[model samples]
Target: MSFAKVFRTRSFRDVRQALLEREEIALVDVREEDPHARSHPLFAANLPLSRLELDAPVRLPRLAVPIVVFDDGEGLAERAAERLEELGYTHVTLLEGGLQGWRDAGGELFKDVNVPSKAFGELVESERHTPSMPPSQVQALLDREANVVVLDARRYDEYHTMNIPGSISVPGAELVLRARQIAPDPATRIIVNCAGRTRGIIGAQSLINAGVPNPVAALRNGTMGWTLAGQALAHGSSRRFDPHVDDHVRLVSADAARNVANRARVGRTSRDEARRWAGEAVRTVYRFDVRTPEEYEAGHVPGFRSAPGGQLVQETDMFAPVRGARVILADNDGVRANMTASWLAQMNIEVYVVDGLMPADFAEKSSGPSARHAPTPPAVDELTPTELRTLLQSPGTAVLDFTTSANYVEHHIPGAWFVIRSNLEQALLKLPAAQRYVLTCGSSLLARFAAPEVVALTGKPVQVLSGGTNAWIDADLPLEIGETRMASPRIDRYRRPYEGTDNAREAMNAYLEWEYGLVAQLGRDGTHGFHVI
Candidate 1:
């Protein structure tokens, strides 16, 4: 019998009550991104079964924390629970009826990814009446060369892809820290924008909260609104705020940010207290270095993961899935952590900013991927890139790519079939009969875990590409592009209408309409424990 049969289950009411009462619970959606986005409870975090081992240890830290896993109808919930059990999770339970159960029980299901953070952004705008300027108005000012500065409150990559002409990248949490320097003149008009709405409103409000002496407004609906108004966006713009800040500006920014955090009842803890909290087996504590990725890779605290402040606020559910868990944020500068904690506190999360840490304290350093606590993968036969290339020439040999659909479409070994690890059984039935099989993904870490399972299913010779697709690329081998051979549907990632430049006008308009109604939906759902100050 499967271990899933032995596991207990929680009804929708039980999970909802836990969230309403602010009790600790991780209502995890174990399906891939597309399915989860189509329908799911408001607070459910998407932790796909394919990447569970890679993310679970970091997102859901405590083994004893109550966890309720679910899937729409793909039979992934039980498998996910079993995997969690094998990973030593003590309190794993399946959602009684999965997604269907929630719907039948009158639970509100949300569409799109990052629902909590996006909904919170809408709520913030409703409550604060965050000021905004339409794209045309901002464009007029820019065209006339008025005393206005456009600050793009998105990740650097997002900003580089497309941005308002003459705008500088000042990602969300950095607004308060860097805004003064970018527009030192107090009378200059400051406009913030994101791909859609969340970061723009949050960034503009952050400057207001920090008591910056400038007029501020968000670019309404961000680049989407700009596009709707038939405005052209500058591509490949690389303008950014200077990292260096004067001592006076840093001190003022720190004081103002701390004041906002204090108003929101965000706590401050010493490193010792934070360490104690992390050591508690009963409590789930997430330690994050809310600094830029480049800075984090240079040096950071020993246990803290790199979660840039802007993205953390934009996707809180992704970083800390277990609702009501303790979250501790760190940064060498005093501004970023406190500013980020203020937002988390208003979102009803128990958050803290670490105090009394100097540059010397960030002793631990890494120049590679963040450390992950995945289970030891089963040993499998390995093949070098040259060997795989030689093997591909032989008949009756098949190569399966287990990377994301997006990556597979971008580039892969010639004639490789794209497959989803969770649906491998069905995927294999679509492939031609082969005497041997080979598995590979981005870095071979995921492929290593799937090799044993494939070997068991195929009952044939199986091997993994030594370094996965990256190694093949390094070998300068010929590659193919597009969805040439797809064994499974490309449902691993949901294409957000707000990302990239080629979005349809209808989809972009519909996305804005959805955001407009989020506040009303929040009221209807009644489970978000938010308290905006």
Candidate 2:
């Protein structure tokens, strides 16, 4: 089909709707990966116009599926569509005004989109959550409370380059885990701000999105509002005012790390104890295999959960709130899971490392015994693409495509579903448990690390894509593609209050003294995180 004939143009709202519904459409941005990763459609999968080879069609499941492509004033969408047509992708379209049009339409974009559009949509639509705060209200609250916390959601370098006078730098993803460290009082108002509106909005929304009760809001129009309001913008100022004062060494001994790993209060199940915990006699054991989202999606041990090591480490409280919930860390190696287990143990959270469940690359990443070990996984047990396609037709087999969202969009095995690794739980709940579960990714590693956890969550028989879908593609397997997907909740309307970290406390006298003392020692200290002024 001609680009004009088959294109179903979508606005941000339309795209969001598609993403919300989990429709079968591909939102293709014709920009390169790096720039696009910084800010683009939350649901849009990227395929640079420069590489729309006919081989691309072989990657996708169905060439007939709608493929909407856009460009960021690069004037490349038309070329991309034309190329797709040449590749026998008859159903191809382009954004009329390109990326700029989407932006002008108030399309929901993000800074470094983390979760998939569907996963993020689920996060955005999570009920019992409030919408973001209007920009004015956020500013007003910050003005009213002199001590109110205004946190910059960008990275450290970004904050150092330009920021408000008193705003603290707390990257958005870090907000939840570190909240207690930034804001001391639940009563303290929190205001989230970023270079522009999206990050601030989403960052604030993430907390409120998770049902955090603190009063929080996003800076209206971002720092531009502050500037327009006659407030001065600060730049090139001291990056670290208080200076880091930690005396503890970054120990790398495996034994030392394991000891630290043993201290976590969550996910502390020992290999021997894990089997017992999963027994029918136990009250309930939520088996979670902590690894990269890839490894978990690849294939986990039976009766386990799939969560990334980083998120599991950071948000252990949210995933396992039952306090004593049995937690297991499944990696191909013992390093990370062990170290993570140790940290969780130290935190008073019960956790354990699944000795045999480690994925590959653990040992290489580990230098000292104290460093986390990344275990290599066993040879992948996978289903052929044709087998996967047949299984999808079965009464109870659900296929989860565990590749990066963009890769999944460019080409994925037929009948595969998308699940962002970071938000697997949120995404999984949206699926039906009536089906058997099968996970696939670019590599066997993801499927292997993920399968055990799949069976654990759904109580369904689960399997992995033996070598992963990429292997299937390498064998020239059949594929499918679509243009539309799920939509995100429209949440930018309201003004929410900002409360700082719950764990934040006034620095003790000795802590303050040490901090001041370290301020002078910073030149070659290799210290981290001391922005106190």
Candidate 3:
């Protein structure tokens, strides 16, 4: 059947103008979280094609309106429309041109609350807020520049390849948790850098969100930009790690233990209580509904604001700046949100965990969001061999070696592939068709997250080696531990320079402001644009 028969459609330019005019249109985007972050049209809300069906029941009611979706390419748009139709929605349309077609139509693109793109833009244009040292204005200040801390927020391996002379290694993903360790002196002007732009900007802004006293900014793009500005990149590695974890900030409990289910946090309340909180005051209690944004907008607790679990945990101070104020963390799936609360508790922040608390949309609608980020915990103390062995028996069970590819080559599991924390998901996609998914990280945290993503996408059951690779080794499992890699990945590097061959001046200005404050500005737009296949 033709997709057009199933979906109404529109041109990108038409949709763009409609959004700007604030017409009653429901702009929907169907793409994964990360890709949506990379690039998309302005004002597109991400529903991700995979979640279109699950979200439709709630999705339709919010929009007594029209929805438009896009895909990277192929018939994904039509397929998605079909799924939406199955749920009985009748008003969605496809973008006439996929992202590239829109791009061809002079379709302006946005990084969609993307920190990296802003950071990269900042790196390219140095005319912004970079604690300037123009020869004449601050010659003496430059001479007396004895107090500044620089951090590199790219992957540590990238740090090993090349870094700024005195910067510290802090992965962007780890910034909010480890910021204090990197910049102990709140008085210091904290500067962040990355190999390119995004991580540095995201990292810097995350610190500000966490309430770091230092005025944080990206090093205008990072080592790449530094080099373009006639600076040299350094070689060799530096000590990397948060200086320390607060001993007092010990884990009261970890994982999906029963205690995790009952833990308390500030904003969280019983379902009845949450409904009451929503009625009391919209601004007093910052109720963060920790579900995907699509799920939130379709319907949420009346007074609640939207913040995903991972981003919220990493940016608590930014969302709720008033310390000692209340915060409620909620999720459709209770366990993972509770697991998060366990960590937040040790962070010494007052918080709460509420189960069965949902938006008013839940009462009005009958559907749910697609697979949530929650991990289902089995009701068992030790992982049973039966479960473990079944996961191993599947030929397609992905064996991800968290160790470096080099370590992988030295002798790892025979069929397992090498995937570092930074690039694990991208690799998972190209794996041979598998019946189930298995993962190995140093411990279970990475697996806990990654394995579930597969389930969400492919609906496959996933398990990580219980103790990670160590568990495999402890059991004396048989397979290659270290046998030199058979081949190297065939990949090349490319750079997209500031192609100002044709662009409005306002965009260029926004790009410049973005660089100076990349860290502090991610997702501030509070809207999204995306197209994926």
Candidate 4:
């Protein structure tokens, strides 16, 4: 059969109708993060062409699941669709007319990533009227040493970077499980804050939903509000919630969280049942251990990947791009998984919690990174760090760094030029002609995949740097920092207003204003299946 006959094209209306009906579908944008963030369908998850081979299996678990790939005139969708088919995908289609078709059909293209989760947060605040306190009131309470405990509902790294005075890092899903211990006094006011609004609102509401005794309120606009009010944030704060909860507290928290989950209509499944679902050929089931990364690394179920509950909720599209697929969360303590599942349930996902698991059930233990599945890279000649250094001294030898723009700016080989993997053809044309080329990314995994492509493009002696740039760093080799030599534009990452410490005041205000209007936008789009209990 011809390629066109095997892989058909899907129109914007067809994709939107499928989403509205909650049918299984993966609407993917094949561009890099920066372009994808500039505009895309509300549910379009970014699976960039550069890392598609590495992330496809994990993000889209079912090979036969329907997938519609699109690109905004970058000429990447058809190539991506072909790659998916090469990777054994049975059902892959191109989006008709690419991203422009969606615009022509009057589809709403959302800005920034994680639109669904952020929009859901806005909806919850709109419907439940989740209580919030502006920065001024919170500051006034803190000045007088009021009976309050501040909890930062962001990752530890973000908390360490900048935080409210005397705030403890409790993250989003951790709030319900750790609130009582952090503020044992029922009279103590509990305030939740993130860099911005979403996590703050969700964390405060999570505590309230779990029936915590203490009064809770979101720090309105989060740390952004604090900063805009001329309040100085404490940097390098180390305070964090203790993970070791008492047995009685664990049981109580688990009961409360489970009750919340039940109210949200989340399902419960046994380990055996979850395995059965995973083994089914017709369905896609993602098994995740929804615990802190440290805890997950120490011990976890064999097949479950580590997905911290807070991040999973905040970045659901990135974690599970196949909308309407079944998600099974495994948490030994029970509170985190149940609470996280409650939010996912309301997000119109078919989510379940693994019931009745003992500590012994988590037999697999690892202190390293989680396992990822990808096609074996084509064999290419590799030059060790020392050998590459020697080769660079000679003429007609060039190095291409396929790492992220952020990483390239931070540190890279002394003379290596930054290049985007998907845009290699154009980038190579920009570089001076060389007799031989060397490819390296942060870990060389991407470089290995790009070696054959480089050979096919230039017919040159293309080789990968052994162990990648990281190995060079480990070898005490000199490195370069900043955008020194760029063969391609740095469009791999999208800088968010909430990230980093030096964001302009105007940008921060604009981000909060954008979030405020998400509820209305969600209504106009009319595809999200979110609800509030």
Candidate 5:
């Protein structure tokens, strides 16, 4: 049977109806992140074609769940459907006319990454009336060195990139737990900020909800707002939260977080309860350790994955792709997990925090379930860094680097051609007929995944560069720059308008205007079940 006959085709109206009814749906965008970010419906989850096989089983664990894949007429949906079938996904379909069809049907399209969560944040501000201060007010406080501590609720790396003149990296969930130490005097004012609206509002409210005595407010629109106001941000700032927290502080913080969680109606789960949730066949359960990355790296529950509390709240869809999934959070101190669970509960996700799981329940392992569950990749020949250097001298041997496009442009092997993993077959046809092919990425994991496909396509011996480019750089090898070779279009990554050094001011303003209109769009659609207390 033809694809049209075998799998159902869903129109924009059909998908919107499913969303409105609150049925389980995985409206997956099968294109790479770049195009997916440019335009897509609010609820669409991005599972790029490059990593479909690796991500599908975890993100969409239940095979029979409804999945509708779409692309911008890139002809990727058919191929994605075939792959999903191979992976034993039962109810896979393609969107009728791809992204363009949604536009034609009067469906509202959004720009940038994490649209649903960001839009919900805007709604929360509109509904809950989260307190805030404009960039100009914040600048006056900083100029006078006022009794205020600005906390950046974004990841540390983002804080390091650019920040308010004196902001410290406390992240989102850490705001309630770490606030007292940063601002000992109950009279001091606290201001929280992130790259955009979501984290800033959430972080500010976390402190207020936790009942901190000091006044609290969000930096009106975060750093974006600061920039739009023509305020200069500090670049390469190293300010961080003090890591040497005392036991007494930890206990008090945990107590405060627990009280906030109680108000939000977050439930407490035991080990057996979490296990039972995980065993349920019909409902999806996500187990996460809501702690600092360092603590998680030191030791964590064997089955729980590391999702620091702040980032999880900011990027809920990426972690729990299935909207209605059950999530059980773990943390030794209980502060981070409870704070994070409070936000997730408000988001209408069924969430729980493990109350008193023992340290013995954890193992000292850094790998997550995704890596452990990855099927033993098909065997392929391997080459060491020393051996690969000799092979590069050959005329007919091609070195294909599967690293991200931005990284490829920065530096690569002298003759390496950047290739996307999913586009390997087509990319191979464009290469000169070579005797052997060598694959490399940052860690060689992706290269290994692509090796079998490369071998089958060219009928040539394919080998992985052991330890990948990191190893090559460690060995003092010469590198090339500036898109020296390209077998595929640099379409894998979407550069964010809010990120990097030279963002267009007009684009940033346009992005903010788009975000401001999201609540109105949500009113029109009526699918997102976001509520703020």
Candidate 6:
């Protein structure tokens, strides 16, 4: 069927009108992050085809919510709409001209992921005049051996990748809880940084807002600025916050953070309240355990998914795709949830922290049953590694690798054709007809998710390679490198302009210029109800 006949389309004007009226509409970009990051509407959520099953149920819980899907002419919107319909969504439409149509209609396009949240951060800085120190001044402090401590507010992996010299991995919400532990001497200066500006500003502000005693300032423009100033950055650093603390101290800190959250008008709810919210069919509620991955894996609330407080604030759009949904954060360490909730409240989300769960309720269940929302694998044939090897050498059999594009580029089973599961049907049309098909990913769970889809499309017996490529490697099988075989374009992930070591100077500068103008754009967009408290 033609897209024109099957799907309704909203013009850029219609979308803009909906936004201006503050109607609940999800302007979703069906393209992957890389293309979506290049340009999208201010409120456009990147619900890439690859992650629709895993993310859409949580992001858009209301089946009847108005949703408009678009692509950069990649022929993905219609497919995405189809998937949404299969997922029981009732109101789905396509953007009239996709991305280009929005451009032709003079709708503003934003670059980078999390544009709405990041722009709100910029507005926060402008309104509150968040204090910051230039790279040169911070460098002077390091050279002088002054009583100064630098805290990297990004994820630990990001800090380990690259960081300011002498910075410890503090992450986002941890700043308020652990600042004093690192800087016992009240006179010591505290500098917070991320790869770019938002987390740094928010981290520093979090400390200031929580009334930390030590002087706190963001490393202006963060690591990007540090690089622009020609300062050396430490790589593979192991400096991190001490995990141990007195119970009394943690209780006191939690109390203080709760006070800050209360002042900011952030709400609190009991676990019972969260249960009631979960049952509300009219609204979507996300129950997230705002603790470290280690902590969560060790033991978390039964129904809560792991979304570390720091990363949750950094990537809210990716975590909770729906704009007007209620979020209930869970953490055994109360300080993290309170601090995280404070920021979300400022972002105009109706956020609350679960406050009444007992210590026993958070017991360790490292390897237990899956969470309530875990996807059920479609019933399909399974093949062990040894069996799959024999089939791969057969005349009419093929193997599809469903791993990330980067991982596929690095290594995969020899002769395995890399393919995105979402585009499996279209991708299969170009491949040679096979009597049987085998699907494999890192752990084979994702392979199971795609197995039934491929079966329905090709009318072939699809088998998942049990234990995936990892099992193949364990058996000492040969692996291929580079893009040896690709059935789909590499558009699964976005490369950040400010991340890593080798960004072009012009792109970095252009990125900064774009950030500087976001507050103005927010004013014009008028859709985001962001406010600085």
Q: In order, what lDDT does every prediction score?
A: 0.92, 0.52, 0.51, 0.91, 0.85, 0.85
| Tens-place lDDT digits, model 2, residues 125-213 | 23314244554565566667655777776656667777877778766544543444455477777787765454565566545533345
In model 3, where is the ten-residue run with the lowest total lDDT? 491-500
> Candidates ranked by lDDT, best first?
1, 4, 5, 6, 2, 3
Candidate 1: pairs in clash:
none
TM-score of each: 0.98, 0.34, 0.42, 0.97, 0.93, 0.91
By TM-score, how accurate is candidate 2? 0.34
Candidate 5, residue 192: the lDDT equals 93
Q: Which stretches of candidate 1 lie over 4 Å from their true place?
A: 1-4, 367-373
Better of 2 and 5 by TM-score: 5
Candidate 5 steric clashes: 0
lDDT of 4: 0.91
**Model 6 Cα shift for residue 112 (angstroms):** 0.9
Clashes of each: 0, 118, 24, 0, 0, 0
Comparing 3 with 6 on lDDT, the higher-scoring candidate is 6
Candidates in descending TM-score order: 1, 4, 5, 6, 3, 2
lDDT, candidate 1, 203-303, per-residue tens: 99999989999999999999999999999999999998898998889999999999999999999898889988888888889998988888888899877
Best of the two (1, 5) by TM-score: 1
Clashing pairs in 6: none
Model 4 stretches astray by more than 4 angstroms: 1-7, 367-373
Highest TM-score: give the candidate number.
Answer: 1
lDDT (Cα, tens digit) per residue for candidate 4, span 224-299? 9899999999999999888789888888999999999999999999998998888887988889898888888888
- lDDT tens digits by residue: candidate 5, 1-533: 55443567999988988876667778999899888888898888999888887788778877777889988987788878888887777889999888999899888887778887788788878987889999999999989989998999999989999999988999787787789888989989999998878899888888888888889999987888899999999999999998777788788888999988888889889988897877777776789988888878888887788899999987887887776678899988788999999988887778899977887877757666663234556677888888998987768789999998999999898889999987777887778879999999887877888988887788888999988998999999999999777998888988777787678889888888888888998887677777777
For candidate 1, the per-residue lDDT at 153 reads 92
The deviation in Å at residue 212 for candidate 5 is 1.3
